[model samples]
Target: MSNLQNGFLLDDETELKTLLFEGEQDHLTPSTSRLLLESDFFVVAGRIIGHSFLNGGPCLVGLSQGIIHVLFGGEPETATVTESDCADQDVREVIRMLQGTKDLSEEEKSVVLSLTLPWDLPGVTVNNRHWLQEKILLHAVLERTAQQVKQIRRGLKDTGVWEFFSSRPDAVPVLFPRASEAEITPQMVIDNINWPKDEDIDEDILSLDDHCLIMSFLRRFIENGTSDILKSLLTFWTGWGVVCSNLEVEVIDCSLPQSSTCFLTLKLSKNHKNYEDFHQDLMASISSAYSGFGQI
Candidate 1:
């Protein structure tokens, strides 16, 4: 659900101007400045992370303390703020105590203003800016969503091409496939005299060459312990290219981009037994679905 449905105030489309103009009109400038006055804390003890300033104001926070600090566009220099250690109570306990509402005095708020905030991050950049500030907040949300999708896919244990493809709603057609394809067998390659993966062929002979090439590629997937990689590759493949296709070829991957991968077994029918027959069918179907992926 979207943030608006849950009544959350923090949203990408939230307008800072509307927030700043909420109350009294006379002291709007000072009140707006106060609303923007966010401090960065260094430690749980409430040492100043960086002094807060108005948006578009001079003071810019750095990501780290040691980096020569400067106020906005000035030459890089050292920060003037001093760091201090508070008494050893956990900071959250202090926050709870303050929120209990035993009626805080005006003097107390002024003295302990720094204690109210959490941590002091070094600096803010366009990458970390707010939505009403810049567009980074939206991009961060998308990055987080992508990471979650990857995480969910990793948690599944299914190894079959059909089961794996069905699990993800967003994943679709894989490589091209034939209508009545038969289980692919090693004998099919050994029995078929001339196959496509071979170089020389007469125009009259229909060879299983492409099937051999695909089988070899499948063999490479397992040659280097890339079952999980094969799964992802197949996920994109079957999810988008072929609807419900299966293969029984070996994979011989040299190396993988990450830790885990997957492999599948392709079963072919009697008439569709040879590699070339399946390869031709797959190529034709895939070309119709996604035109350019196979060419490269």
Candidate 2:
């Protein structure tokens, strides 16, 4: 499921050409390419998303909300379409112009007509400006890719979970979470850790200086890192981008960091000289783990 999602939807390679969907990071909508429609790629994508959710795997995050709404049987006209939902800059600009109260110039009218002409939509006029605006929004968000969206619905039905999805409106967000909802926070990471408790240490003394320093560095790094960096780290630690519960951290006798994904344990070397050394080793270890290098 992860491979399918990564390869088909989220991969950088697919962004160069329209295979199934369009848009950069997140905000993906169905493509209107006839070849893609004939290939039934979107149906396969829908199956991947449904099956992934059923198996406790990664959801198809970053899908356009308007598409999702229509996928779940909501009316295209009622589905919210904003400028951000329109991938084409020209169409988005025209959408903005229609949203405002000011009348367009003759040249601007020509541009609007030229853009909408491809969709067989009527020309914009004083009487039908608002109607044209709605039509343009629908065209960009739903009408252009209507067949692709229909195929996605067909694909969802193939998984047998379509009824489940249709019945429970709440599950839509869980199965197709927005990019922001899936974001990991520093506190989330910190709270999930099962901090080591040393029974041998005296009550008067706190944690060892080296342990304290390394832990502090870990927190600081997490707090300051970008979302991608954090996700990479999570993937390194848990063998998946999603965080697991009760991750155990151990300060042990080792030359480099190591993780046991099955046990959710992370072992860090206690011999770091300073933050620089720790950061260098940590990053190297994370890179190694991510690439499946230096694993037993």
Candidate 3:
């Protein structure tokens, strides 16, 4: 007011350009803005979320609204140019209608594509403008994937379907595990599995009851397990190949990241006389196996 006679301040296009072109701030913010050309419907990849101080500099954000919108250097202002105001009438308008900016259509796209000297023009490079475009696309795709996974988890929770690993350290149920387990009392083991003295042959020592019980247990495991786990089990069950090199076991997880692993339990009867000793031995074996000091 004091420097100028009129209220109108001096317009300094040079200063405005300088400020707008100033580089982004890396640490304080994390939002990305790759301007996109709007289609009939909003494609999820074409939107910016959050706010970031981009120390990365004023990138020529890709097409949006069939126009160019340049974000100023860390400022709220974004320079805009509409398709009507563009230089060419035969811009790829038809091609854009058929294919989104995900494909190429210069007439319909706001940004230009060129490979000449000083190639940093706003409208150039159909698919490859800034690395930020891919980042944005990947971010959106991953977000959708995560959402779908959450939905699946909710569905699984509503029903009683989840993992049923053989052995896990901190075994807990993500969802109610299918009831494939039964109490193995000492009497059952003795009556069904015990064999006559000095019976070393597998055929001679086998018991029908024990075999059937094991089969029933496996059925439960397959029924409750994931498709992948079930396939693996079937593959092994079919005797794909029998090799004795090292004892190995795999406990697969088929649930959400936030949820707990599948339920699992197999041991001597809790009320058995040797339960304490058996528990001690089992615990030791588990600990040692994890520590790489023991084998199955």
Candidate 4:
């Protein structure tokens, strides 16, 4: 739904069918029995198959179709060039011509097809029979590029860090890892946390991961009447993993996210030293949320 809201074209049922299988007119069938898949293609194909099984359905035939879509559509593809443009030119030079694209615009994407696809044209077809065999090397290069791209994308998607930053690319200061744990103070952690962190953090300071884990704990505080959460945060010694019954932490009052930017203000115990430092870091995190690097 977020992807839809973000203007991404969701694959509809028809498009999904076209993606998974040959259309009725294409008359293609799966060849599952005697397969000699390359190592890289096999890995990509396996992932798509698994994704389809879990998301699409349990059918094996559907899995095969899904694999086919991922191989060609692993990423957005370039446009094909028309046959006339590169008809008389050297195919190698034509390839060299298109290699500079850091980002392919819709118009230019297919332009390279004019060079390579025509290699099979009537006049050129007879002369390149040998080159066609050599095309195996070209196929290998493309397959390898696609494999590498999938792994890169998968890694980024798995880490919430990617979502956090990609949603606000201009937030450079927040990109740095939280200051070393030893240098962080409990008050510093409270100042910065608008959400629960991913790990049990020790006292010196709570890092970004700690905030992600703690967000949930603070929600009930909002429901309860106590408004000052600062003292509760300081109860556990730094570095405690799971909460202890004796020293369980709780939130009092807090403010976050009247907007997408979380401007958290925790009233940790009064008279804490480095109070100004924690405020500065909280401001930086808010600035990051707003896509502005906080003022140094």
Best by lDDT: 2
RMSD to native, candidate 2:
4.5
Distance from true location, Cα of 201 in model 3, Å: 12
Listing every candidate in turn, what is its Cα RMSD in Å to the true structure after a full C-alpha superposition?
23.2, 4.5, 25.3, 19.7
Q: If scored against the real structure, what TM-score would every candidate get?
A: 0.19, 0.79, 0.19, 0.18
Model 1 agreement with the true structure over 5-94: per-residue lDDT tens digits:
112243458532222111111111111122222311111101111111111111111111111122121222232311111112333233
| Runs of candidate 3 exceeding 4 Å displacement | 1-203, 234-296
- Candidate 4 matches the true fold with a TM-score of 0.18
Worst 10 residues of 3 by lDDT: 48-57
lDDT of 4 by residue, 1-296 (tens): 11111122325654331121111211211221112123232333334434433342221221122222333343322322222212123444434444443544444434544434544422123344344323422332233234443542343344333344445645422322112311333434444344422354443454443343344333333233121132222211221111112222322223321122112233232222243443433333333321232222
lDDT of 3 at 273: 26
**243 in model 3: Cα distance from truth in Å?**
20
Highest TM-score: which candidate?
2
Task: List candidate 1 stretches off by more than 4 Å.
Answer: 1-217, 225-228, 240-245, 248-296
Off by over 4 Å in 2: 1-27, 33-35, 100-106, 199-213, 251-255, 287-296
The window of 10 residues in a row where model 1 has the poorest summed lDDT is 40-49
The clash count of every prediction, one per candidate, is 53, 0, 19, 28
**Per-residue lDDT for 183-226 in model 3, tens only?**
12223222332222323323433444443443344334434545
User: Against the true structure, candidate 3 has what lDDT?
Assistant: 0.25
